[model samples]
Target: MDANRTLALFERLVEIESPSWHEAEMARACEAELQDLGFTVTFDGSAEQTGSDVGNLIAHRSGNADGAVAFSAHMDTVKPCAGICVMRVEDERGEVLCSGGDTILSADDKAGVTAIFEGIRSMLEAGGPLPDVWVILTTCEEQSLLGSGALKAADVPQGVDCFVLDADGAPGSVVCNAPCHHTMDVAICGKSAHAGVEPEAGVSAIQVAARAIADMQLGRLDGATTANVGVIEGGVATNIVADACSFQAECRSLFPERADEAKRQMTDAVTRACERAGAHADISWTLDYPEVACAEEDAIVRRAKRAIEACGLSFQAVRTGGGADANCLRGLGVNAITLGTGMANFHATTEYIKVQDLLDDARLVEALIAEYAGS
Candidate 1:
């Protein structure tokens, strides 16, 4: 892979401000690049559902080999990235890319995108036998994987093993397991009265919510489970008893049963608190995305291990608490795993990626393609 070319592409991508739900410009740029590389590109009709300017970009190219493999990366970035300015600096370690101290570097998935593009370009330039390749650039990944969730099975090619290049770690880290996430919205309704005059006549919803939260076991339920109430809203004034209180919380667990049990416990806590306080509780739960676990013996894992080793790096399978496009793809019966792209401090202003790491990621992608081609 060409290091300079890869860095140039990375710079271009990160400089473009494509926050979640607004990836039209980035998609257009990627589409043009893919088309220039001789891949047929098409945009899906998921924008209306995802509320993005453009849909997912699906690019394909036929190769001389028999089998096919798919690669994916998201085109969206987190907030504070509207006017990104990438700066390349050299430290004792090596060359690193950073932002202008005002926003995130957006290397989380852009580095992945650059790697895939450079890898495919190198393969094509080599003019040798290569397996059929499908590249999917998704949108709204930062917002709970809205783009990938909207993808239909028909949009993906059949019998193609998929891989997502969006993990945050060294190039050789492979994510084999991720937790299932569920979000809960709770509303507590209580009678309102003047706090100083008729305090006994009012049932404080805030009190009910606080009691329920205190009774529940939050933050690290066990090795595989965790819960937290991140957002709360309600109350009118200090002199008046609160009439309604609402809170948004989430729970995650590697095991589905554990997550379900956590939800049940939380619901029970809310019910008990509301009953004791003479209030009514309204709760709703949503499954954000399912868990994904790939065995070491799986073909995708095996190929990825080989490819990582081929790039002169030790391969390590890891479990993550975050959700990615891989979770949705796995739920759709596609064998997929997430691989790191050497992004550090992602979703923050301190985000950065090493130049050598970018090159190594490209090499890993090329090696994976070679493995698929049986070269």
Candidate 2:
């Protein structure tokens, strides 16, 4: 791979401000890059549903081989990512790319995108017959996985496995399992009245929500299960009894049943709180994404292990508590796995990727494609 070209591409992507649900200009930039790489690029039209400015970008390149393999990474980043300036600094792993103290570096998955693109160029330069290569750059991946969830099964290629390059850690680390994520949104309805004039006739929705949250077992429930109340909003004034309160909470577990039980327990807690306060509680539960698991002997795992080793890195199959595009892809009935790209402090202003990690990731991508092509 051309390390300089990969670095330039990564810097260019970082320069673009592509917050979730606002990936129009980023999509166009990637589309033009794909065209330069001789790929047939198309839109999946998922923007109409996900409310993103652009749909997922699907790029394909016909190859001289029989089989096919896919690669994916999201084009969206979380907040505080605008007007990023990529800076090179020294880390233990050598030179690193990061933001310049004001905004996030947006390397959570842009490094993944760069690796995939550089891998294709390297494969072509190696002058071997290539397998059919497909790329899926999704939008709205940060906010509840709206982009990938909107993807239809037909949008992904059939009869092959896709490698999702959007995890944290070393380049060779593969997520063997990812948690099943669930969310709970609640609306607490209570009677409102004057605080001092008719206090007895009023119910405090904030107090109801507070009591519910207090009764719930949040934070880490176990080694695999975790829960949290993320958003809470209500109450009109200090002098008036609040009539309504809305809250958002979430939980995840590597085991599906455990995640379900966590959500259930939270719902029960909300019910108990509402009952005690004489308040009506409305709760909605969503299984955001299903778990991803692969056996050590699974063909996909074995192939990934070989590819990782081929790139002179130790292969590690691990579990993760976070949800990713791999989960949504699995829910779409496609086989997928998440691989790390050495992004550290993601979603924060300190986010960065080692320059060597970028090169290693590109090498890993090339090796994986080579393994699938049997060349």
Candidate 3:
């Protein structure tokens, strides 16, 4: 691939702001690029479900080979993505990309996006045997893979092995294990009273929440299980004892049983805290996405390993505490794996990608497609 052309694509995409539920402009740009590459691009009907301005982009191109390979990436970024300005820094190791501004660099998946396109271009221009290539650009992936979860299985072509380019490692890293995400919301009800006049006559819901959180087992409980409370709200003012409190908690694990056990432990902690405070507890749980467990012997995994090795890079399997598009794809029986795109400190202002890493990632993507094509 031409490094300058690929870098231009990345910079152009980074200039466009595409936060979760707002990927309309990004989708348009992707559609145009895909069309220029002789791809038939269409949009899925998942906007209403994901609340995105646009749906997922499905681009396809036929080939002479027997098998098909699909490359996937999300089209959204986290907040503070508007007005991004990318700056190139010269490091001894190589050139490094940074925003050098208040907002994040948005390389979290824009790196993935441009890498796939560049790979396709390079592979297609090689004039070798080719396999059918399908590109699925999803929306709202930052929101627990909401866009992927809303995808219809029929939308993606059947029997097309796939992988997601949305992990945080160098080119050859593969996320073989990913956790199942389960979230719980709790609401505690208590009696209200004036703090100064009758403080003892009422129970503070915030106190109950504090008690429960303190008692809960959280923050990497074991090798594979983890839980945390991320959102909490209660009370109207300081003068009155808080009558109600609500908080959001979540647990994730590579093992389903372990995730379930953690959820139960969290719920029991809240129950005990409410019991001690003489308060009523209302709780609910939602399974955001399922786990991803791809064995080395799996065809897709084997192909990826070989492709990475063929590109002269190290290959290693990893487990992530977070979720990816692969997590949702597994539930659809697609069994897509997650591949690294060298995005460091994603979702933060310090996010960056090494120039060498970007070139290597593109080469690896091209190798992956060629490996599948039997070329």
Write down the TM-score of every candidate: 0.88, 0.86, 0.85
Candidate 1 lDDT by residue in tens digits, 245-311: 9999999998899999999999999999999999999999998778977789988888899989989
**Cα misplacement distance, residue 113 of candidate 3 (Å):** 1.2
State residue 113's C-alpha deviation in candidate 1, in Å. 0.6
TM-score of 1: 0.88
| Tens-digit lDDT track of model 3 for 28-142 | 9999999988899999999999889999998999988877899999999997998999999987746899897699998889999999999999988998888888999999998
Q: Which ten residues in a row have the lowest lDDT in candidate 3?
A: 326-335
Clash pairs of candidate 3?
A: none
Write out the backbone clash pairs for model 1.
Answer: none
lDDT of 2 by residue, 42-111 (tens): 9998999999999999899998887788999999999898789999998675799989979999888899
Clashing pairs in 2: none
Q: lDDT: which is higher, 1 or 2?
A: 2
Number of residue pairs clashing in candidate 3, backbone atoms closer than 3 angstroms, sequence gap of 3 or more or interchain: 0
Best by TM-score: 1
